[model samples]
Target chain A: MSVENLAISFGSNQVLKSVNLELHAGETLGVIGPNGAGKTVMLNIMTGILKPDGGRLVFLGRDILKEGVVERVRMGLGRTFQIPRSFRNMTAYENSLVGAVFGSGLTERAAGARARDILDMIGLSGKKLEPAGKLGLLDRKRLEIGVALATGPRALLLDEAAGGLTESEVAEILGIVRKVKESGVGVIWIEHVLQTMLHGTDRVMLLAEGRDVICGRPRDVMSSREVEEAYLGAGVGARTRRKRA
Target chain B: MGARTSGIRQIGGAPGPRGGWAARKPLVLAAAVVVLALLPLYASDYGISVGILIFLYMSLGQMWNLLAGYSGLVSLGQQAFVGIGGYTLAMVTQAYHMSIALSFFIAAGVSLAFALVISFPIFKMSGVYFTVGTWIVSEALLVFFRNWAFVKYDAGYNITVAYRISMPALYLGALAVGLGATALVYFILRSRMGLALMAIRDDESAAEARGVRLYRTKLACFLISSVYTGITGVVLYLNITYVKPGAAFGIDWTVCMVFIVVIGGLGTIEGPVIGAVIYVILRQYTYNFPGISMIMLGVAAVAIIMLAPEGIMGAVHGRFGFRLFSTERRPPPGTGPRQYPEDAADV
Candidate 1:
């Protein structure tokens, strides 16, 4: 999947301008920036939540800008929200079953089995029948990713999956992301946790003011002067630069 | 050890709290059906008429529940389809020379067509705007019917089908329609479409992201609801033996339906059934006190909203874990509370 020359504006404020990126199979790309850098908007456009003013989003060699959200999901693009919007009234198992049945085109029995497997994989097997509303925050985030995975996606966009978690919880999420990568599905993860992004991703992209400041290997991008000026401060950049030296 | 043993026994003896409730639901439903079927045989004429009224309201309440409660349409103009059904039945039976039984189907078709046409525009508005849009549509239909030439505008149309059919047959037909509509809703709720509807109800954007065709699913719900509401309208006017624009397209129909659904339970299958019975009985008792009946009903509705916003079934389900519909998932036998309590706190 690739986005070329993506642009979007909300009235007078332009959110994303000429944003370009390409995600290949089994690759994990980490996107980091200060708030209002259009990280979520980029993910939104890729997942067909927002229509760009000008751009080409090619998935499996077809322009999918006109496709609706459900059609895009069925076509192998899956996304998780930043706030973990699980169907609170439904059980975690039923939440995953929805993605499997409708998004993955599985039969009811097959969907049930798939949902069970996902809940188990997400480490929520014990609480599978619990209403999503009753789940703690970490479990809710896990269920969100599990629901996305149940869609049988070739690519996944995770928006801040580790935002409010502890260090160990962040490590757990990284492990899940690594496992997802090992399964040959491409992933674009937007995160504010710099350490998590730097350690978890194969490549990292830095965005500032709706534009890419740098995109390359995580260490190289972190040490670059442009990224230092745009996002990472001089102190952190110098420390990373000194460590690399 | 005693607690563990009792828990195991509970799981083994019944599925869960919800499961135990579900286990008896079918039997109860079957018994109710049998009782309703036998009512016309022994019931007095007045009793049968009241039964017909209850069944009619029950069906209308169910349709409104599906649209507003489950699908989140929140329409106040359901009387539009109701009016359409009555007018269509009148026209088909009198002008087209069709049988009264056949006119029911014709009215349904006409109402469905009307719903499909208007849904495109009405559904564009969300929440309160949609409610207002529906109300406006009903008012427009009422005005059109009032001015139209064929059915003798302002004077209204007298349904001649009432003369042909016996009161017993009419009561039986109303019962059948009520039962059929209720069953249709139950089966739909049990289907994939129903799952999609509930998901949409919870969160529309998230549901769409999970591959629910939002507009199409909601429109299908609107059309189905319109058909049933239309049929109820035909049954209602047939029993009354007259149809006027004021009564047919009146807001009172919508008010009663909303009250029945709210008092009974907004989204549950059995909510409308329980609600209709309570509403009908209350109406019957209060009909003798015309000035105070409306006041009493208003007070009851306000009490229900303030006390149990989720409706009676929702409150019952929350407190007693009763579930006749069995929509919730049953946890595996060994799964219960977490092993580490601190793990929950760390997150």
Candidate 2:
């Protein structure tokens, strides 16, 4: 999957002026950015939650810029929200069942099997009867990814899946992402946790001010002077200015 | 504890929501239908009248539940379809001198078409705006029908043929509609579309991301709901033998639907059944208090909503961990519960 020169704006606030990225099969492409860097916006456009003002999104040799969200999911592009959005009133099993039945258009019996497999995979088999609204944050986050995976997508877009987890919980999330990548599904992981991108990704892209500041091997990109000036350097300068003020 | 575990299995079984008495649901439903069908034969005239009210409100409340509880479309203008339905019966039977059989189909067709037409504007709004927008459309229609020469201006049209139909037959018709409405909700909730509808209700964008088509599913639900509401209206007007702009298109119908669904249960299948019974009994008793009746009903609705926000059925389900007419899909057998870390259960 590839996106080129994607852009969007609300009112006069230009969210994504122009952004580009590519994900090869079975690769984990980590996207790291500061607050309001258009990471979620880009994911939204790719998933068809929000339309890009101008861009090209090519998946499997087809320019799917015109496709809607459901059409995209059917075409094997699945996504999780930045703030986990599982169907709260439903059971954990039923949440996954929705994706298996509608996202993949499986028959009821087949969907039932698929949903069970997903819950087992996500380690929610015991809590299958529990309502999703009753699940803890870690479980809810796991269910978010589990629901997306139930669609049987070739590529998965995860938005801050480890946002509020503890160190061990974050490791568990990384383990699942590795398992997903090992299964030959391409991944675009947007994260604020620098360590995750450093160790978990095959490649890293730095997005600041709605533009790709750098993209390369994670370590190489992290060590670059441009990254320091745009990311850490800006942070230091802001703090020093605040101290003086 | 043992009972609770078995209850879990009953709901979680692969064939869906069956075990013990639940396994005999179909037989029970059939027997109830038989009894209701035979009701007018043994019941008095006043008893038959109350029975008709129960059936009609059940039909109306179920449709409202399907719209607000399942599809997440809270429409306050369902009265528009009801009014349209009653007037269609009047025009077909009285104005065109058509047979009663043809009028039922015409009323449904007209209501379905109106639903489609209003859906364009109303669907554009969401949440509270959609609610108000639907009420506005219904009010606009009320005004349109009042002045339109075709509907006899302010006077309204009467279904003269209603006099030709016997009370028992009308009761039978209401029985069919009430049973049909319940059956329709049951089957729809059990279908794959039912999952989609609940998903949409829970979260629209998430539902869409999971490949549930939003507009198409909503439109289908709206159309089905309107057709049933229209048919119920026909049965209602047939009973009264008179249709007027003020009464046929009044906000009273929407109030009854909302009251019944809210007081019984918002989304549960059994909610409307219980709600309709309570509503009918209250309405019948309140006739002696004429002026304060609407206020009394309002007070009753508020009290019920305050006590059981999910309605009586929801509160019952919470306390007992049981559901009848459930739309839940549980894991297959043999997938024993997995253990979670101790801290995970803290929340």
Candidate 3:
């Protein structure tokens, strides 16, 4: 999947400007930026949740800007929200079953089996029958990822998959990310957890003020002056440096 | 493995040996059906008329519940389809020489077509806007029908002698439609489409992201619910032997539907049945009390809402863990404890 020359604005405040990126199979691209960097907006546009004012989004060699969210999901693009928006009244298993049945076009029996498998993969099988609204934050995040996985996407966009997670929970998520990458499905993970980005991703892209600052090897990007300057400009560099120290 | 076993037990385990209330539901429903079928033989004329009214409201309440409670499309203009159904039957049976029984099907078809046409515009609005849009549509239809020259300019239409069905047949027909609608809703809530609707109800954007075709699903629901409501309207007017534009399209129909569903249970299948029974009984007791009936009805509705916001069935289900109908899935038999790999948290 590739997005080129994408531009979007809410009134006069431009949120995304000429953003260009490409995600290829079997690669984990970690997107790191300070808050309000338009990371979520980029993911939304790619997933057909929002339309860009000016751009081309091509998935498997077809322009999909006009496709609706459901159609785009059926075409092998899947996403998880930052806040983990599972169906509150439904059990975790039912939540994933929806993704399997509708998004992946599986039969009911097959979808049921798939939902169980996903819950197991995410380490939430014990809570499969629990209503999503009652689950803790860690379980909610895991179910969110599991729902996206149930869609059988060729590429996945994870928006802040590690947000608000404990250290151990983040580690568990990174392990799942690695397993997903090994399965040859591309992933674009937006995260604020620098350590996870540095350790879990094949490449890292830094964005600031709605534009790509740099894109390279994770280690190289981390050490680059442009990356540090961007972070520092947004009041994130000192905190990150202190955390690293 | 130990944790897994305990977790399953904590979550109420599998369907037990007694299998909860859901297991006994079929037997109970069958007995009720038998009793209802034999009612005309033993019941007085007043009892049969009451039964017909109960069936009509029950069907209407169920359709509205499907639209508003399950699909989260809270329309206040269901009377639009109800009006269309009544008028279509009146026109076909009286003017077009169609048989009364055949007119029921024709009225349902007409209402379905009308719902499909109106749904395109109405669905563009979301939440409360959709509710208002439906009310406007019904009001517009009421005005049009009242002014239309062919229907005799507000003199209204009546079922002529040539197409009049017997009273018992009308009551039985209403009962059949009511039972059919209840069964249809029950089966739907247990199906894949029903799960999709519940998902949409919880969160539309999330459901859409999960590949539920939002517009198409809502439209299908609107049409289906409209068809059932339209059929109920035909049975209703046929019983009264007359159909006027004002009464057929009145907001009172919508109000009663809202009251029954809200007072019974918003999303449960049995809620409408319970609510309709209670509503019809309450109305019967108070109908001769002059202005006191409407006030009594309003007081009863407020009491239900204030005391049990989830509605009567929801309260019962909450307190007793009894579900006559359920969409929840049971665990696969003999499922063992879930295991996470040893290094799962190591990154």
Candidate 4:
């Protein structure tokens, strides 16, 4: 998947300006940025939830901007929201089954098998019958990923999948991402958790003011001067401080 | 796991803790239908009249439940279809000189077409706007019919044939329509579209992102619901043999539907059945009160909404963990807990 020259504005407030990125098969790409940096906005545009002012989103060489949300899912582009949006009234098993049945367009029998497999893989096997609204935050986050995976996507865009998790829980999430990688599915993960961006991802892209400031190995991007200025304001950067003195 | 999946072809195949009742539901349903079919023989004329009203309200409540509970389209103008249904039967049978049997189909088609037409505008609005949009559409139609010479300029058309049909035949027709509407909802919910509707109801953006076609699924639901509401209208007007614009397009019809669904259960299949029965009984009992009855019913509805927001069936399901008409697929034995939380049982 590749995005080129993506731009969108909400009135006078330009959310994204000419952003671009690419994802290869079997790779995990982490997107890190400060608040209002358009990370989620970009993901929403990619998933066809929001239309960009100008951009070319090519998935497997097919421009997907014209397609709607469901068509994009069927075309193997799946996403999970930052906030857990599981069908609260449905059981965890049934929730996953929805994605398998509709997202993958699998026959009912095949979808049932796939849903079972997804529930087992996500470690929700014990609480398969539990209503999603009743699940704990950790379990809900896991189920979010499980539901997205049930779509049978070639590339999955996760918006803050581990937004509110303990250290160990984040590791468990990362472990699931490893399994996703092993299955040869590319992932574009956005996270505020630095540890997840540093360790779980193959590469990290630091976004600020709706543009990619730097893209490289996780440590390199984290240590870059641009990232510090982006996060802490330009006055806090070493070079800016020296010039001020 | 294999055993559970093997029965996937059945609607409620997975064996839950309440397996005995769940498994025997079909047989019980058949027996109940047999009893209802035999009601005319032993019951008085008034009893049969009440029965017919219960069925009509049942059909209307189920259709409304399908639109609001399942698909998240909270319509306040289902009377538009009801009125259309009633008026179509009148116009087709009396004005057009069409056969009564053919009028039933025409009424359904007309309402279905109306649903399709209004969908283009109403579908654009969501949440409260969608609800108000529906009410406005029905009101507009009401005004249009009132002035239109074709519909006798608001005086309404009377179906003379309604007198020709016996009470038994009318009761049978009402029974068929009631069961048919319930069966339609049951089958839809048991199919893949059922999942989509519930998913949409839970969260539209998430459902759409997960590959559920939002508009198409909603349109299908609206059309099905409208057609059934129209057909029920035919039976409804047949009972009265008199149809006026005020009576046919009255907000009271929509009020009855809302009251029935709310009193019984909002989303569950069994909710409407219980609600319709309760509503008919309550209406019959309150008939003597005349002036105070509307206020009394309002108080009752408020009490139910406050005490049990999920309604009677919801409270019952929460306590009993069983459904007479199950549309859910539970986990296999030992895979999960025997009993789920209230929400899981809601399906």
Candidate 5:
């Protein structure tokens, strides 16, 4: 599932206005923005977690907004929140089990088996039975991705999965994202970590004030002047600061 | 026991609390059920009636646990449904002369339909609004039942029965209902729906952000709890053969459910079972005293909430990190990728 020409708002605050983007099979698109700039909102709109005030969301050329989040998940559209979401008291294995059993239509025993496999993929196989709340930030993020992956998604939307991680942790997360891409899952990753996102993503989009400032190749978009003024925080934005000199 | 011994015993046994609650609990519950199962057969008629009341409260507690505990609905007005169920049973059995056993199903269906309609409005509210809205709605129900003409308002209604049901029969009936209620809560918590409910409890908005259908999930839980509780009300009326507006619509029903789950473990599968047992015994023993029983209960509940905020099951969890029924993952010692194999697991 993918999005095109989407628009959304929260109350009077316009979160996203006429945003255009697409994600194909096994490709990655990076959405970069500062805090509260509506990166998450755009992802939410795309995944049908939130409804748009205007515009079209076509998943497989069918209108996706007509369906609910759980149905969309069943149709292979999965999302991860910026803060990891799990059943706190449940084992990490059980948290993923919800995705497998209900979202994937697997039986109870099958869901348990599937949860263990997902735990392994995210490098959390040994801790399948640990309560999710007790996990540290890094493991929590991994479980979030594992939950999305556990549903056997064709498209995975991640909201800041690598935030608050050290350099090595960031590299490991990048490896997981790449591995996901390699497995033929369409990926849309929203992150503030420009360096890592640049390294992991094939295409980069600059998001500012709910709309994309620029969208194209990682190098081309990052070097664009409008992107620098809004995001990328590249020398174009810094050059404006130097112009004050 | 020291913390280290608990640690060693846990590892030497199961790796975690996975099979812990499963093994010994049902055996203990079976023993308790056996005792309760036999009490009414040996005791006098009034004793059997008291046994029925125990079943009533136990079933209510189990139903409440599904909504307030497992689903995190935190309702305090289950009494509303109790009145609805009782009055509906009385109306059916008195006017229509429906079979007493079938009245239970009738009352449940009516109350569940009403609950679904009620959920349409209440499900939109969150936090305090949700809690207070239910209380007010229940109070409205109390007023309506009090003034309703056919049911005799505050005075109550009388039902017609073909014969005086035997003491052993009532006891067995209540026991059956209580056990069924507990098992239903257990199996549901052990399934897919249970995970979604606990997710609502942990962080509702985050759950929504991750594709959980907040309103539908909550509404489903509300209807299920209300229907089972409605059945409990009908059972209470069956044993007593009468129900007054104040008695049927009072806060006692909610109090019993809350007391049981709060003391037992709130969200754990075994929490309500343990809580129901403790509550029944405490009520039975304390009723022997005059006024002090209420004070004792109030003090104990307050003290437990303060000293053990997690309740009985939570305390167990704090000490051993055991989850009786959950599938969330915790990271082990290092960054060794401790996730479950999303494909298969012994869990």
Candidate 6:
């Protein structure tokens, strides 16, 4: 139900230091921070892609400090990368099939059925047979989402889902996440695109220099002085600081 | 429509176009072997030799497919094991005077064991480093075998029995082994073990996170691959009635296997078959042309990589919804998007 004092250290650098955060059963938490503020690191730690040095990580009221990425996924937790990770040799459809069989626990035929349906839903049905290596940015992003969705997570963590999208494309993806939330799945999205986060999420969690600077309503948190001086300062820079703050 | 399309997902389960490939593959395989069994009875001497060579490479290529293609290890020195297998068979059968079949089995066993022992050190290296380490290992093996001289490094063979260009018995034996190897690859890919292999290929860390005990999977793949390649070496030496360190441990074999699997379809079941058939035909006809064969093969590899990186299996998958032989499925709609689920439905 919540993260309890999760901390992670990569080599000498302690990326996350005793970070405690949570989301309600039906809420979206937007994570925003400076580039190296450990936003993606925090997501990796949560998904068990990276191990924590100290502190506890709980998923659905169970300790997940030691579970691996796929185990965490099987425990109803899933995530997508900032840069989409797909099997280059497989088709868009086949890539999702991997998620279905391994991540979603579907039988062979059932997995194909589900993968086809997911591709269709993501507007990748026509491109499903195309090699994943040949896909453009938008379709690759969609494929990333489709693969993650195939795992069927109760709580999905997205890392920069709209990184390279046009504004309209961003809005389209924002709608997809919103629809996902409607299916009773909890979402925590990290994005540098502030407006998309502000307009899309029900709540917001701002990470700064490996720590949570602000957590609450998106607009309120975005407008907070600590966030402005640290996160938005990094985003909007010192020149526009006064007006934005 | 997603729901309706989901119903059609059952199409692959039926034996519609591709034959009863899934269920009766064993029987079909047996029949093919029987056909091969009768080949020497009617075939000309040259035809038998060509057929035997095809069987040998098919075995080598399938094993190479497991190591280089599915596991993404991409070793360029697998010929070292081929040398080891041939020499071991030759020595044991010659000096020790063991049975021919026993010599082949022992060689396979030794190579499999040896490969398992070294996999850990080799795999510890990063992508290209792993490949380089294997190459060095093979080269070192070649040097050692050549210098030992007790195994007749220069002159090659000391077969007590005079043999034809090719024998019916050896061809039949090679045919059986080749069929077994392809079938073995098919079974491994279709099983949970193959899943672990693919997981390692696609994303190593992700597979580890999912409790895919990497050491065991990697060891199994290496050992199985070594055994097949090793057996081929035995067959190769026996057919020629000679075994030399240089010829037995030649890099050409490994290179050819890689070329075949790469062009056929790197990760698909049928890729190696297509690749092997094409490569064998080219090799059979191109010996007198010298380096031209290598140049053409190299050009073909570059073209395949630049144009069709996924190879023919991927092309088939892209053009039609045909897996041909892959057991992997596309995660269907309503199954949710991720591969693993807390519950079965993933809903």
What DockQ would candidate 1 receive versus the native complex? Answer: 0.27
Better of 1 and 4 by lDDT: 4
Q: Is the docking of candidate 1 incorrect, acceptable, medium or high quality?
A: acceptable
Off by over 4 Å in 2: A223-227, A235-245, B1-18, B331-347
lDDT of 4 by residue, B1-347 (tens): 88766677355555664676767778988999999999999999999999999898999999999998888888999998888888888988898888888878998889988999999999999999999999999999999999999888878777998999999889999999999989999999989899899898789889998889988999999999999999999899999898988888888998999899988998888889999998998888888899999998888889988988899998988877667887777643345322211111111
Docking class of 3: acceptable
Instruction: Report how far residue B249 has shifted in candidate 4, in Å.
Output: 1.3
Q: What's the fnat for candidate 1, on a 0 to 1 scale?
A: 0.42
Encode model 5's per-residue lDDT on B290-324: one tens digit a residue: 78998888887888788878888789878976654
TM-score of chain A of each: 0.93, 0.93, 0.93, 0.97, 0.92, 0.92
Q: What is candidate 5's lDDT per residue for A1-245, written digit by digit as tens?
A: 55666778778988887677888888999988677788888877776667888887777778888777777887778889887877676678777876776667676676666666677778887777777889988899999998888776878899899989888898888988888887777899998776767799999888887776788888787766776677545666887767766
Q: Model 3: per-residue lDDT, tens digit, A1-245?
A: 88888889989989888787888988999998778889999999998878899999999999999998888998889899999999987899999889888988887786776678778778888888888988999899989988998888888899999999888889999988887787778899999988789888999988877788788999999887667767675357666666888
Model 3: per-residue Cα lDDT at residue A59: 92
**Against the true structure, whose DockQ is highest?**
4
- Candidate 4 is scored at a TM of 0.92
User: Per-residue lDDT of A66-156 in model 1, one digit per residue for the tens?
Assistant: 9988889998898999999999888898898888878887776757766777777778998888889899989999999988988888889
Ranking of all predicted structures according to lDDT, beginning with the best and ending with the worst:
4, 2, 3, 1, 5, 6
What would the per-residue lDDT of candidate 6 be over residues B1-347, giving only the tens digit for each residue? 99867668666455555556666766876786787789998899888887888877888888888987777778887998888778877788777877777877788788977787778688788679988998888888888877776876566766543263248887887787777788899899777677667767777764544335566777788888887788888877777777787777878878888888878887777777777777777777677678797777677678877777888766877788576455654433454443222222345
- Poorest stretch of ten by lDDT in candidate 5 chain B: B338-347
Please state the error at residue B111 of candidate 4 in Å: 1.3
What stretches of model 3 exceed 4 Å from their correct place? A234-245, B1-22, B160-168, B330-347
lDDT of 2 by residue, A77-112 (tens): 989998999999899999999988888888877777
- Candidate 4's docking class is acceptable
**Model 6 ranges off by over 4 Å:** A1-18, A23-26, A51-56, A60-67, A91-93, A104-142, A152-154, A165-185, A231-245, B1-42, B143-166, B195-216, B263-265, B268-271, B284-286, B289-347
Best by TM-score: 4
Candidate 3: residue A217 lDDT (0-100)? 96
